[model samples]
Target chain A: MVVRKYFKIYLRFLSRNIQSSMEYKVDFLLGILANLFQSILGLIFIWAIFNRIPTIKGWNFHEVAFVYGFAIIPSGISELFLNNVWLIPTVYVNQGNLDRILTKPLNPLFHIIADGFEPHGFGFIIFGASLCVYSTLKLGLSFSFLNILYFMVMITSGTIIYFSINLFMATLSFWLMDIVSSMVLVHHLSEFAKYPLIIYHKAVQIILTWVIPYAFTSFFPAIFLLKKGALMLSFLTPAVAISVFLIAYSFWNFGLKRYQSSGS
Target chain B: MVLKSKIKKYLALSKINIQRALTYRISFLTSLLAALIQLFVMFYIWKAAFSEKITLAGFTYSDMLTYLFVSQGINNIYGWYTTVERNIAYKIRTGDIALDLVKPLRFNFARFFEVLGISFVQVFFIIIIFTVFKILVPEFRTPKSDLYLFLFLVSTFLGFLCMFSLSFLVGLMSFWTLNYWGLYYVKKSIFDFFSGAIIPLQFLPLSIQKIAVILPFKSIVFIPTLIYLGKFTIHESIFQILFQALWATALWISAVLMFKLAIRKVVIHGG
Candidate 1:
């Protein structure tokens, strides 16, 4: 019953944000177009590199594109729903807006996650989904019911992982008010997910898998879908995603307790 | 005497900018760390690409690595400063730009000096980091000659001018538009793709390469890195430097003209 109430509230918030965004229709459209252009540009970068060489680490162009597309979909989903998590550090902690949020009856976390519903994120979803479908068809991968189910699970897990990482970084702002740099560092590191994980050094691969776990967000899932090796690790993506989210959530709460309003 | 006084004024403004940058040292350190990670990622990608062959697309492994390192290093030295762009846009949106317009200093030049001050600090740290990487990684290579190095530095200065002018124009767009966030992303995507920061222009399609050569974006990253890698002969390096200068001058004039037009349309919407 409580979940339904929150869902209704979230829907209302989404409608309001959409209405406001629509008031500036050109800006909204341009924002989406820009995101689409960026997504296409990233794919073109991969394509240019592949044009020079037939393969890298035994991963062909289509295979790498598949991974890139899969990675983007989850990132897009997270950006759609949880981009506000990124602003926590700057808006809530540094700027002391958390005090106002704390006074509200709604759950602060939910409020933060749902308040800023960017319609531009749909551009990422459209581009990503189309790329994924095209790549899957081009690769001639036959999908069973189980395969489709697994794909859904993997995307969900990937979105959670992306949100968890952003939340964990934002949580750090409670102590380190200027955490934007750390966010940028993590963002740059995550760019490796656009390529096949095998291309990186083993140390980097290991770090991406275990420490940062960006590998699971796309690499492992892509390999699983491709029926490549590392079956055991690929199957562990959901578990890793869940654990990371839990840890990040607990950390956020812990940080919240420590957050003394700047009182500006 | 007027020229000397103007120089002193800019120097003092730059000093203040440098001090402000130091106060936000963590931001610089993080950005440097981000650049290092990018370098490492690109290094591994190229290493894997070169595993089976010594050369691809005219770039040997050493050449590719050097190009990657130098491009990223140059980018760190003078690439996008989002803070500056945001400051300019925010001031314009909030009507604070009127105060800036009334100042005696030319707005564009003042902003350039301030950005240059920050870039000076960035280049210092990047040099130290690159020096360490060179010692630690035997694969790293430097320019073949002191003359090439001299030309590379000159190209880099031109590159900085090109980048600043582009950013200034983007900021000036705020005078006409209520929001420029989308424009900023669009500009960034174009710059990243055409500037050869993500991939060398040679690796791109012939048509795209032709387009890139004509665009100012390549002057910001591709030219200096190519010069550093000795991909260009002495004659070609001279030509490329001249091209960069041409683009820089053209962009500066366009930016100044756009700013003049934009100022007329500037409507302080609210307090």
Candidate 2:
């Protein structure tokens, strides 16, 4: 009953967000264009890299593209659904706007997440999904019906993992007041996951896997797709996603309780 | 003299920007740290790419490493610190450009000086960090010769001029366009490619290389970094320095012309 009620509210807010975004058709279209152009440029760079060398570490061009596409799916989903978390440090916490949010009857976290719908995310999703299909075909791989079901579930879990990290970063703003740099730092750290995890040093691999766990979202899923022999460890993605989400969610709750608005 | 006072005025603006670099504390530091992380990723990616071969695309392992660091270092020193496009766009949107226009100062020169001040700090930090890396990490390398290093320094200053002029040129579009962001965003991606900030220009196919050569973008990172590597002959280095100066002057003049053209259409709405 509670889930259904929240779902309805989320749908209403989403429609309102889209309506407002649609009001500025040029701005909206330009944003999508910008996003698409950036991704395509990144693709060209990857192509240039492959032109120089056949593979990086044991990963071929197709595999790397697969990993890149997998990374984009989760990132795009988080961007579409909950990008407002990125503004927490600079906008809400510093401006004492949390009080206004606190007055709302709905859970502030849900409200924040549901209110955002970046049209640019459609660019990411479309590009990523096509890239995934293109590369898979290039590599002569095919997903069975069951594997397709698994793919959808894993993509959701990957998005959840991304959401957890973003929420965790935003939650830091409650205590630190301004965490733009830290956010940038983590953002760069995630960029490392664009490649196969094995390409990095052991230390980087360990950090990305255990500490930040971005590898589970991007690399492990790609591995599951590439090597259909089913590396059982890839199944750990959902569990990792859930654990990080709960931790980040709890941290948000704790931070909310302790949030002292910048009333001055 | 009037010229002397104008130099002093710009210098003072530069000084103020250096002081303001730390006004937000963690913002600057973490952004630097983020750049470091990006460099780290590139380092590993290149290392992995080079594992099987001594050289790919005319760059040995060490040469490639040096290219990556020097290019990234140059970028870290001068890039994006000039948030000129967004600032101009916002000011134009909110009609704040009128206030700036009435001021005694030329806003373009002021913005340049401000960016130069931050670049000074950035150069300082980059030197210190690179020196530390060279001392501690055996993999890191320096310029092949002192003359090459000096030439690189000269080239870098000109490159900074080119970058600022190019960015300011784009920022001028704000006077005419309501959605200046898309243009700037597109420009950034294109800049990253043509500038050789992502990969060396030589790595590009011959056709693309021919095209990228004509653009001013390569002067920003490609020439200075290649000079540091002593990849060009002494005569070629001199030629590159002259080329960069030409680009800098041309771009700066064009930007001024763009401003003159754009200012005529300035309709600042909804202050």
Candidate 3:
């Protein structure tokens, strides 16, 4: 019942955000167009590279495209719902807006997430899903009902991983005072996952899998979906996602205890 | 005597900008780290690309590494904090641009000086990183001749002007648009692809290379990087540098004209 109430509040906040965003229709459209253009340009980059070389470390164009497309879906979901995690340092911690949020009846983190819904994220979803469908068709992959179910589960797990990582980084703002650079570093590191993990060195691959676990966000799950082996490891994504989310949530609470509201 | 005093005034403004940039030590470190991570990623990707073939589009492994390092370093030096477009858009949104217009100095020139001041600090950081990488990485190459080095410096300066003018014109679009974020990303995408920051223009298909040659974006990274790598003959380098200067002049004029027209239509709402 409590969760249902929170869901209602979240939906209300989302609708209000959407309404305000729609007030500037041109800006809204342009924002979505920009994201679509960016995703297309990324595909073009891959295409240009593949034009010269047949493959990069045995991963062909379509395979890389599948991974890249899959990667964006999770990132887009995070951008849509949890982008406020990025502003935690500057807007909430430094500006002491967290004090206001703390006074609310709802959970502060949930409020932050619900309040920051971005419509531009739909552009990412559209482009990513289109690319995924195109690549799957081109590759002639047949999906069963179970496969479709697994795909949905994998996407959810990937989104959870993205949110957990972002929240973990944003939680540092409580003590560090400014965590923009750290957050940017995390962003840069995650960009590597857009391509096939096999192209990178074993060390890089290991770091992405174990330390950062960005690999599970796109790579391992992509390989499994394509039936390229590593099935057992790919299935671990949900477990990893759940654990990471739990850890990140606990860390945020721990940081909240130390958060002495800044003087604005 | 008047010209000397004006130069001093701009220099003073630049000094203030430099001090302000120094305050963001954490940002500086993170930016450097970001560059290094990019270089590392490129290193591995290019390594895999070259595993089977010794050369792709006349770039040997070492040559490509050199190009990546030099181009990335130069880009870092030329990088601006919060693109001029977004800065202008924010100022316009907040009505701070009205105060800026009241100042005696030209707006673009003031911004140019501020960016130049930040560039000085960025160049310093680039030098430190370059030196450390040179010592550690055997593949990093220096220009073969003093003439190439001289041409590179000239081309890079012109490239900065070309990039600044383009950004300034984009910033002027704030007069028409309520939000500049979309425009900013679009502009950045064009630069990343056309400027050869992500990949050398030569590696691209012939049709795209032809298009890139006509655009000023190539002068920003492609031409400068090629000149730095001594990929062009002395005469060719000189011709490219002249081309860069030409584009810089043309873009600067266009930016000035756009700003003049745009400022007249500036509607500062909700001040």
Cand. 1 TM to true fold:
0.94
For model 1, report DockQ: 0.64
Compared with the true structure, what per-residue lDDT tens digits does model 2 show for residues B1-271?
9999988989998898888875754666666777788788778878888896789888888898888888998887864554678778888888888887787888888778888888788888888888887887676677788998899889988888999999898888766567776777778878878999889998889999999998999999999999999999999999988999999999998888888777767743322
Model 2: pairs clashing at backbone N, Cα or C within 3 Å: none
Better of 1 and 3 by DockQ: 1
Interface C-alpha RMSD after superposing true interface residues, each candidate, one decimal:
2.1, 2.2, 2.0
Candidate 3 docks at the CAPRI level of medium
List the RMSD of every prediction in angstroms: 2.2, 2.1, 2.0
Residue A141 shift from truth in candidate 3, angstroms: 1.2
Tens-place lDDT digits, model 3, residues A45-140 = 678667788878778889889999999988888888878888888998888999999999989999988888777788888999889989999989
lDDT of each: 0.85, 0.83, 0.86
TM-score of decoy 2: 0.95
lDDT of 3 by residue, B1-271 (tens): 9989888778877888789789987887787788778778777778888896788888899999999898888777756463677778888778888898888788888878877888888888889888998998898899989989999999999998998889889888777679898888777778878998888888788988888998999989889899999999999999999999999999999988888777767643422
Total backbone collisions for each predicted model: 0, 0, 0
- On lDDT, the stronger of 2 and 3 is 3
Residue B82 lDDT in model 3? 30
**Candidate 2 lDDT, A1-264, residue by residue in tens:** 889999999999999999988887877777777777777776776788888778776678888888888788778887788788887887788887777888998888887778678887777787888888899899998868987888898889989988899889889998785676777678667787777888888998899999999888888877978983347668988999999999999999999999898895
Ranking by TM-score: 3, 2, 1
Off by over 4 Å in 2: A228-230, B176-183, B267-271
